[model samples]
Target: MSIKTQKIFEAEFLLEDMREIIRKTSPHSAFSKDDKIQFNEKLKKLSEIVEELRTNKYTELKIKYITNGIELRTREEDFINIHPIQAAGRLTLEARKALISYGDGYSTCDWCRKPFRLDKIHRPPIDEFHSELAEFVGMDQARVVPGARRGFQAVVSSLIEKGDSVLLSAISHYTEFLAVEDSGGTVKEIPLNEKNIVTADATVQKIEDVKKNTKKLPKLIMLDHFDYMFGNEHDVYGIAKVANEYDIPFLYNGAYTVGIMPVDGKKIGADFVVGSGHKSMASVAPSGVLATTDEWASKVFRTTQMVGDITGRKFGIKEVEMLGCTLMGGTLISMMASFPKVVERTKHWDDEVKKSNQFLDEFLAVEGSKVISEYPRKHTLTKVNTTESFDKIAKTHKRRGFFLSDELRKRGIVGEFAGSTRTWKLNTYGRTWDQIKYLGHAFIDIAEKYDVPVKANKQGQYSGDV
Candidate 1:
């Protein structure tokens, strides 16, 4: 039975931390022997598409309705509740009245401009459907999390108290310092700058060096509208104008900048924010999203239903808040019906993430290397080198980014690599521009045959040059 549940989820399993870092970085024995015979013919075409979806040979081919979000859900349904949080707040008010009647009707009914079926849309009006997702992120309310880290531990247990004082950013996002030390609160951190950018004048000089050597004014702050280990992008309205000149609170994390930047989290004076809906709205995976103000959403919904009524819902809280409310009801009805064509397919992967950061900053400014910041964020930045060449550019861009995430999972294409940097994540959602110029010419021919500085003829300094 599935090899006895893969040997009981691979024995002594702590979810095989990235398969034990791909088995102690033997990383499938660093490819080459003709890239290990094209990665064993791409693992036998992903085991012939998982043995043709286990012999049904594609039971009417529903690769989650041809991938890229909203295939309604199904791993054998049943989170029965005429209650998946009240049928996901009545399917987020029937997908906000089919996104305001598919943006004010005017349809010559080709199935009313196709795409509606989450069982034919309807229930909208839960007080104006999560107030149009809390006024589309300038929040005055929002708290939906099928997981934005329990909407960041429901705004750190409704704005800290049991020994408060939380600031952030000494290389942050370690799950917002484990949700402010599992909510008894304390954190502190601050430091960053030699291009690992975290400024608003270094978070107002660490809130003026913690109010001139600490007695606590840091009631809570947090950061990350980019800067997941070097794809830096911050300013967050100049650190919410220095947390409104020290009235404190802040909290941004916009989980990789909510759908890749242009967050308003109330014109950036964030009292709270956090997003992900599976990293910018395709949802699935423990979704995530949070927001604030309606007096911090009735004080984080009474500290998130008093930690969901004394955590009866499980061991260590978050029992799939109904699979994060059915992947936040198919990630907010596939992000309000294809968020303006997912921002017009993110301008064809913003010229392949500015030509893979000017082909890794002209291949590390011709081995003189440096460029962490002179401006780098069209979507995730940071190009390494500070002697150890950060462990040989994180073991040669993690074996060419896990052999381009196993050749984009043999053409079904999915990407991820930003954790052990030589950093690789340039998702140009539902790609093109020759699959981002053949995954940026196979990551600049494996960072120029492992000499790894990376560049060859300035991929003409990005501007419509894919």
Candidate 2:
């Protein structure tokens, strides 16, 4: 197809939509007794304005903006700022600062993390580095907005236009698939290798085969830095290099590995990257980050709304001196503040978790279960896939992760189920080896209760996505 499509994907979270649904179906939170007077007053004012906006008969009201000795009148009574760019430039700085300071640059779990406050009265050090961090995960560098609605949609739409040939994993994140489909990209899944890893070679070979057989070079290369379902690590940097060699732009998503994995965009040499703030960064919910090369950053800036107002803007020295105020920004500030600590603590914990995984791997091997990816190079969120004959395998630890997750919560352990899918990704950080050991044993007990086969030695059979 010679059709050049706009490949943008936008993901939006439906909080306001949910709120409206709740309002119509369950209006309990609509207005309390305290808000009754204010609500009525607002409603009365709205009615009066609506009445004033409507004139008798078909008469029209004109609103005119006078500029350069010319009166531009609008019969439809719509108003727009003549200097939107100027207003945007002025507002962007303050908004950015507020966004940065709201979370006080840190994130702790609801149970174990701490909340930091940046007061409007005191200024923080200006030179602190808050980098956009990620690993070789797959995602395009679109803008990240507050929720799944406006921001994600914009990103998805930009990349996946109708009839474009795209490749993805069958067991990938469903939201990503939806985004691609919405953008009209035709998805083709590359089957898992025998070892189940999405090796760079495997992906490249698939592209070559597709080209040779179907006479088409893939327009876009898509894959995650870390496979979400199988706990497999694709060599993202390797793939990017290959794609670069082949003249294809790589869209990398660093969802599972962003915060936890140490990835450098420049070192990796990828074209576009997107990540989640809540995943690894201690950012608050509804925050995310997208990074690209300076050249692409300009292109994305053109397609995106370049709002200067973020939680990271600063005021004039006179304003700062008079108000004596600073801080007061977005949750990203907390993520920024807490990121180094979180990364440090998580790294230390990750080493321990790897040690634990080895122990479990050996124990399961004795029980006739297979452990995939022996001596895994990085940390992972586990996924267990067995033959169709082993349908009962899911039930073995189906509730174990949840039970352990709740138990950890009790013990102030704060790992999240990365997304709402069946994949229960555990955070190795924020807990001790003793906890993981206990949880491992608990999983064994659950497996036994389900009558799953286990060997007496349980040596090497620990196959899972981590």
Candidate 3:
């Protein structure tokens, strides 16, 4: 489509997408009769433009981008985006609708009330959503934060003081270390086990070593439920038990687990459970949930008591850690709009894991290819080594490392880390079974083309071959 056609196309597509939604929306929802009239009028105008573009032949038209050029990102629409962090975060149709309505900074604050808190606004039932979020993760309280990193900052700032020590997995996200540093604390890493996964026993030993050297119990223990690099599930339950045994506060980093799967903070004996809304909750970027038990919520969400020196003014109800309120815009609204579907999808996590293994079983059939992460994968994000297979071709191909990317792109696949054929990561989180098989076949077909011999699946898990 020409720029002229595409602009009108997108506009019409959006209003039509929201037409059914506005009809089905609750009576108290924000849409009004005037809003409906505006929608219809806009759609009619766009339809006329579309008819004009069609009559004139859209491709022959030259449309100018009057300002900074911006256009639709057709990656998800045009190709299989297997990027690790993105698969689970792709927005729902409902979220897209919400974004159309609440894209501005002040749009979400229209209903701000007496408490003047992000979680207290009820016009769109934001207050109810906050309560639901707490129960979703088996926590007593929850708050929306910018991202999982901010959630970590809140917990670290609350419990960790200057010179305090915290223990975390060796493979934990860098934000964890940054959070600890922000609070003037030191971080101690718990070593990975033989299989490259964090274990409860290792956590205990790390705590013991921290105590031996620092001469005190660590102030906090935080670990990832599933690490980003390997996407392998760590022993969070056992690690949380270890924290309990030592009477230390535990923070479960669910950047990879929450939203995609069911998680119980209390069941894991965790004091805090943090999740990335954009990374896993199908929301916009810079959105996340920070949840905690009542026992720890008071301190973590403590209000500011500092009085303004000049006028003796104080904001007693404003939470100090969250900087009073967070995510007061489309970011929060989109997350709420996607909440219902996110909840339903968590129940199908087993099927998701099954699909991951199904794809990997066939993918590994290409001789010399290797699964770098844990075998029979437990998560969609995977680290793979094709050094012995595709890298061999990269050595002599004209495009070198880019040849593999070129071939994958030809097959309608994208989002593999570009220019790296030796070892790289990909995600299959939300891909359909047919798409997964297509991916597997794409790999095998590419292998055959490059003389990278494809063999039968020894496990018979995926019998189809390219």
Best by TM-score: 3
Candidate number achieving the greatest lDDT relative to the actual structure: 3
Once fitted onto the true fold, the runs of candidate 2 whose alpha carbons sit more than 4 angstroms away are 1-156, 209-216, 303-330, 343-353, 356-359, 362-377, 385-429, 443-466
1-466 in candidate 1: lDDT tens per residue?
1332332222313233333444554845554466455555555555554565466443232233313665533211211111111111212233334543433322212232123321122443222445555666778776456556667776787688667778888878677778778878888877777766677887877777777777668888888877656556667788877887888878888766565445678777888888765555443335556777766555555422324466566323222222222232444443554444433433454554675454444435434345454455455344344233333555555463355344333433333442333432233333334544554454445445456564445455322221
Better of 1 and 2 by lDDT: 1
* Better structure of 2 and 3 per lDDT: 3
CA error at residue 332 for candidate 3, angstroms: 0.3
| All models, RMSD in angstroms | 21.2, 20.2, 5.2
Error of 1 at 267 (Å): 27
Q: After superposition, how far is residue 424 of candidate 2 from its true place, in Å?
A: 7.2
What are the per-residue Cα lDDT tens digits for candidate 2 across 367-466?
A: 4344344235354354432222123443454553354344333433233342222323333332245545554554455456556565544454433322
Q: How do all the candidates rank in terms of TM-score, highest first?
A: 3, 2, 1
Residue 408, candidate 2: Cα error in Å is 10
Pitting candidate 2 against candidate 3, the one with the higher TM-score is: 3
The true-versus-predicted C-alpha distance at residue 31 of model 1, in Å, is 68
Clashing pairs in 3: none
Candidate 1, residue 446: lDDT: 42
- What overall lDDT goes with each candidate model? 0.53, 0.47, 0.89
Judge candidate 3 against the unseen true structure and give its global Cα lDDT, from 0 to 1: 0.89
